[model samples]
Target: MLKIQDIRELIKAIDQSSIEEFKYEQDGTKITMRKERKMIEQVQQVVQQAPISIPQQVVTTVQPQVENIVEKEVKQETPAVKPTNLHKITSPMVGTFYSSPSPDSAPYIKVGDQVKSDSVVCIVEAMKLMNEIEAEIKGEIVEILVENGQLVEYGQELFLVKPE
Candidate 1:
């Protein structure tokens, strides 16, 4: 029989791995694990339910009389610069981001802080469990892309790091 710790280790391995499904059986004791497709469907449903706000903001800010002038001025402004050497740290699963282990504790990382491969950079809370995310690469943190407590999707960019 599989112990609780063995099951937990299996789950962790599944979470960190690319495998979508797994099954095992020994003497009629069976175990099965699969990554749910419902997650993507739920995300799509939430997106559809949420109202689009960007167009409303633009409409409220720009007056009809000066719209043309403002459009030209906006077009002329320089676009935000994206660093070429920066590597994106993305979310491994859908969850809420926590910068610190606890509310009263200091954050795991900050902008300009150096990190090595295997360094725990933040925690993601999913289904009441806290999963610590590692840096996976040696780098200096250049930007934090999500706010604390923000819900992040699978593969969403969480931070930008300039590799050492």
Candidate 2:
């Protein structure tokens, strides 16, 4: 018989494991657990950052799983768009978006401002580090998609630019 504690322990084990899903059945009782895709991705990212050595066979097996996760994430993040001349400046990493270098300072760029390819447009703070985001394309700022100090995700659109 599976008690609530037993099920909870099983879930904890699964969360800590590399396996994506688990199932068990006996005496007409069945239990199954599956980790969310995002959780799996976060685990994979942490594992990649560590210098732990993995067996060749394990590496080969994990490659396909990682590719699948990346594909799913890309599909979810990308939206269909009608053909437009506007170029979008996107967030390079997940963080808190800031328009100005400091609270009292003017914003880096505002609507109708012309920017060069290397122009600093905004900052994104992650893990106490302030990352200056840039306009990778030469253009005029048409729209600002994020408000100052808003949380943003990787690849989220920050500004729309009409190419020069």
Candidate 3:
């Protein structure tokens, strides 16, 4: 039998890589993980009596005036400063963010702390595995965006770093 931690590590490895699905069987036990859940959900809906309706945000409209107004609002919200200069360390997958290796330990990095390209800044726990997140750039940490133990989405900015 595989240890719980070993299973967790396996799940984490599959989650991080480009592979979308994984399966394993040993001694009559089988485990499977699929990154794409939408296909599975659609299959489930077909089997069930109730069909799920997802509303589409896009609408066919003849009004150019409304489109212009929305475009203007979008342009105004995106400023041409600070954000472009800072390096964002984004989450690679959806998971729970952890600032430290364990609850009792000091956080991996804090604002103003120096980090190298290979420095481990934090951990993102997915499927029970603690996957260490690297800085991937030489920099000084500018901000820690997420709170400890918060659920984070894929590509969500977790930290801002001022690259050296």
Question: What local distance difference test score does each model get?
Answer: 0.82, 0.82, 0.80
Q: Model 2 clash pairs?
A: none
lDDT of 2 by residue, 1-164 (tens): 97755665675577688888888999998766565455655766675577566688877989888679668766755656734989999998766799999999999999999999999999998757999998999989988998887767678899999998
Q: Compared to the true structure, candidate 3 yields what TM-score?
A: 0.51
lDDT of 1 by residue, 1-164 (tens): 87755766786788678788999999898876766445645655665587435576677776574578546645644356888989999999867799999999999999999999899999998767999999999999999998888767778899999999
Runs in model 3 deviating more than 4 A are 1-83
**Candidate 1 vs candidate 3, TM-score winner:** 1
lDDT of 2: 0.82
Best by TM-score: 1
Which residue pairs does candidate 1 place in steric collision?
none
Q: Please say which candidate is ahead in TM-score: 1 or 2.
A: 1
TM-score-sorted candidate list, best first: 1, 3, 2
RMSD (Å) per prediction: 10.3, 18.2, 10.7
Position 80, candidate 2: lDDT: 67
lDDT of 2 at 42: 74
Model 1 residue runs over 4 Å out of place are: 1-79
